[model samples]
Target: MFRLVVFVASLAVATTTAAHFPWLYVADDSEPRLFFGEGLDHREYHLPDAVAGAEVWQEAIDAPALRLEMEPLEEEGFLGLAASQQIEPRGFLRTTIDYGNYHGSRLIYDAQHFPAENPEAWPEPVLAPEGLSATLRVEGDQLVVVILHSGAKPLTGAKVTLSNAEGGPGLSAATDDNGSTRFSRAAMIDGLNGLMVMHVDKRATGEISGKGYASTTRILTATFNYRSREAAKVSALQPLPQAVASFGAAVSEGQLYVYGGHIGQAHDHSRENLSGYFGRISLDGGGWESLPAGPPLQGLPLVAHEGQLYRVGGLDARNASGEEEDLHSVDQFARFDPGTGRWTDLQPLPGPRSSHNAAVLNGILYVVGGWALAGDSDGEWQAGAIAYDLCSTDAAWITLPEPPFKRRALAVSHVDGQLAVLCGMTEEAQLSKQVFFYNPASRSWSEGPDFPGSAFGGFGLSAWNLDGKLYAGGMEGVLYRLAEDRSEWEKVDEFQTKRFFHQLVPDGRGGLFAVAGASPTAGHTGSIERLDLVFAAPTARR
Candidate 1:
C-alpha cells in the first residue's frame, strides 16, 4: 500500500510539470506548420520534444507562464526563427532595388504586421525639361521671335537674351503676357553673325514644402531668313494674263488636248449671223490648235472611253430672227480618236438630251440623268439613264439602272470598281451634297458619307485611287480621303485656292494636278497646282 501511494505521488508531480509547459509550432520553408517542444520556461524548450499527442493541450495552459507571447528570437534556430535580424521599420518600402546580382528575387514581408506609413518626403529625383524650340522671322537685319511655351501655365515676365558664337553683345527682351518677346535692334548685335542663340530663364518654386526653388535655362537657335510684308504685297499685286475660251479640249494620254470653243461673225454678207470655229489646247504643252468645224452645236464636248472623245446631242442651228430651233432633232454622236487625231461618227444615242453626266465602267459609257426639251420651249429635266457599249459601234443605246435621286450637273468617278457620284445641282438648280456609290456588278446603290462643308456647286469633282485609298477634291478647295473601310471621310488638305469648274487629274504618282479652274477671286486662273500628300511621323512616348 505504501509503494502504490509513492507511485501515484510521482505521477501527480509529472502531470503538474507537463501542465505548466507551452506548445510551440514551427513553420517549414514551405510554410507547413510542425510541432516543436513545449516549454514552461523558454530556455528549457527543445526541438526534439515535438510529438503527435495530447501534450498540445497541456502546453496551452503554460503559454502565459513561459512568456511565449514575446516576439520570437528571429535569430538562430529558436523555434525555426531565421538567422537574420529583424529589419528596422522604414517609412515606406521602395521597389528600386538592383536585381542584376539577385536574379529578380524580391524582399517580401507580412504587410499586415508592418503597415506602411505616408512618406515624410519623396526620395525620387526631379526631372528637367528636355529641349527648347523657337520659330523666328528676320525682317532686314532685325529679328522677330515667336516662342511657344507648352507648359501648363503661361511663362510671364521671363527674360530672354541673345548671343553669338563669339559671346559678344546680344539683344535682351522681357516676355509679354503672351510669352512673346521681340528685340528692336537685334541686328545691331556685332557677334550675331550667322547663328544667333537665345537664352531663356525660367524660375520655379516648390508648391508643397516652400523649401525648394529651381531655376532652369533653355537655349534656342535663331538662324532664320525673313521677307517684308511689303515685298509679299508687291508680288501679289502683279497682274496675270487673261484666258480666252476656245473649245475642242481632249484629255489624251493624260494631257488635255483643247480645240475651239469660239464663234465668230460670218465673212459673207448674206450669212452674216452664221459663224462657227473650234480649237484645241494640249495640257502638256499649253498651246492651242484648230480643228475642222463639225455641224454647229451649242454644247460642250464630252470625253468617254479611254481612247475616244464624243460630242453628242446638241442644238444644231441658230436663227437670225431672234428665234432658235433644235435642228438636231435626232441624237448625233461624234467620236474623236486620239491615236489618229481624227473624228468619226458613231451610232447616235437613243434619246436627245443635254447637260448629262457620262461615266465609263467595264468599257461601257453610261449617260445618266439629263434634261430633254418638251416642246419648242426650254428643255425639261429628265431622270432617264442610258448605257452604250463602245466595242459594238452599231449597238443601240440601252436603258440601264437609274439613280436613286434625280440630279443634274453631278460629277461621277469610278472608285473601287464602283461609280461614286458627288455633289451636283438638282432639277430645281439647287446644289446638293448627297454622295452615293453605285456598284455596277451588283447593280445596287448605297449612300456614302456627306461632305464636311457646303456642297460644291459647279466644281470639278475627281477621285483617284492612290496606295489603295480614294481621294476626292471639291469646290471648297478641300480634299477628302475616303477611309479604306468605307466608314468615314477625312479632310486631308486644302488646295492653294478656291476654284469652280476646275479639272483634277491624278499624276499617277500619289499626287494630283489641278487644271483650268475659274477662281472667283482671281478670275479664271490658267495656272495649275500640284498637291503632294504628306503624312505625320509617329511619336515616341517615355
Candidate 2:
C-alpha cells in the first residue's frame, strides 16, 4: 500500500509539472520569443536549458524555412528569437525540446508562434508544423485551435486549455474528432492568449538519451496576441454612383460591380425610374468607374465566380413615367467580363425571374426564390430553383427539385457545402422568417432555423458566406453570424444604418461592405458601410 501511494504521488507530481509547458510569443514588428510557463504564470526560474538551447526556425507559405537566432532574455522572463528573414503573415516560429525524464516519465515540448493580431492578414492553407502542434485560426467570431499529431493525424479527445494574459479561470474544452475546439471570442479575455494541449502515451515507455521513462508526454502550445475589446464599428465609404435599391452587386478580383435597379419610390416601377447604369470601383478605394450601360432592371442579384460577374433574370419596367406601370421579368442571363469590359449573353434562365438572389458553390451558380412579374398581372411565384455549371463547355440552366414554399426578395448563400435560403416574402405577400437548406449532393431540402428577427425585418434580407462563415443582415440592422453547428444565428454586430435590398460582399480585407440599399430614414441610400472584425482591448482586470 505504501508503494502504491508513492506511485500515485509521483503521477500527481508529473501532472503538475507538465502544466508548465513551453510557449512562443509573436507580435507585430517585434522579434518573436519563447518561454516556459503555465497559464498566465511565466516561470523565469523554470526555463530549461534544453528548451533554451533548442534550434529554432521560422516557416511561411511559399518561403523557405530559415533558422533564427536565440537570445536569453531572463530579465524579460522569456527567450527572444531573431529571424534573419522576415516572417510573412500566416508564418510561424517553431522549436522542439526533449525535456528528458522527470517524475517517472519523459516530457517533450513543442512550441509554435502564430500571428494573431490581424486575422484578416493570415493567409490560408495554414500548414501545421511537424510533430504534435496546434494551429490557430478565426472563423466568424470564434477562435479555433486544431491540434494535430505526427504532423497530419488529428489528435482526438485531447483536453485543450486557453488562458489570456489577464489570467483567472481560463476556458477548457476537449478536441473533437476533427481535433478542433472553438472558443467564443466574446467570452475570452482579449490581448495575448495562449492555448496548450497535451498527449500522454503510457505505452510510450522508452529511453531518451539513456534516460529511461515510464511513459511519454507530448505537450504542444500555440501562443498569439490579439485584441478584441473594441466594439465593431460601422463607417461609411464612398457612396454609390446613384441611390438605388433592388439592384445587383458583386465583388470580383477586388472590385465592386453594381448593375441596374429601380431608382424611384419603393414598389413603384416605371421606365423613368429604372437605372441602366453599370459601374465598378476598386475596393482598395477609388471613385466608381462607369461601364457601358445594360438593360434597366430591378429585383435581381449578381454573383461572382472565377473573376467574372453573372446575372440571371430580372424585373424590367417598360412603361414611361406617365403611363401605367408595365412590368415584366426577363430571362436574359449574362456574364460580364472585367477584362473585355463587356457583357456576354449566356443561356437565359429557365424562366423569367425577379426579386431573387443567387450563390456560387463548386463553380455552379444557383438562383433561388423569385417570381415572374408579367404586365398588369399578379406575379407568379417560383417555387423551384435553378443551377448553371460555369465550368462546363455547354452551360445551361438545370432545374432543381421544387422547394415546399415560394418566396421572393430572398437571400441565398452557400454554407457547409449546402445552400441556405434565408427569409423573404411568401406567396401570400406576407414577410416570412422561415429558412430552408438545400443539399446539391443529395438533391434534397431540409428546414433550417427560422430567422430570429420579426417578419417585418425579413423582407430584403441579405446573406453571404464569407471566409467559410454565414452572415446576414436585414431591416432590423442587426448583423448575425450562424453558429458553427448550423443550429442558429447569434447576434454579431449591428449596422449603424438599417437598410434592405443591399448586398453584403467581402471588403477584400477580411471585412464586409453593406452596399447601396433603401434605408428606413434615409430613403434610397447610396452609402456604403464597412464592417471589420476588430477586437477591442479590454481594461486589465482590476
The TM-score measured for candidate 1 stands at: 0.46
lDDT of 1 by residue, 497-520 (tens): 455545555543456655434443
Residue 80 displacement in candidate 2 (angstroms): 69
**TM-score for each model:** 0.46, 0.56
Score each candidate by Cα lDDT.
Answer: 0.42, 0.74
Off by over 4 Å in 2: 1-236, 536-542
- Residue-wise C-alpha lDDT for candidate 2, range 1-542, written one tens digit per residue: 00111112324573544556666765445566667666544545456678768777766422357677766665464433344333433446778888888776787777777653444223232344546877765655787888888768789998887776666666678999999889888756556777777777788798767878888777777777565632133223456766688899999888889998878556667887888988988987768899876788988888888998888789888988768989999999988888888889888887899998899999989999899999989988898899999999887788999987899989999899999999899898898988899999999999988887688777897898889988888898877777787777777766756789988988988878888787654446666777664441212110
The candidate that achieves the highest lDDT relative to the unseen native structure: 2
Native-to-model Cα distance after best TM-score fit, residue 462 in candidate 2, in Å: 0.6
Regions of model 1 farther than 4 Å from truth? 1-250, 259-286, 293-301, 304-306, 312-330, 373-378, 456-469, 508-510, 534-542
Given candidate 1, what's the lDDT at residue 434?
76
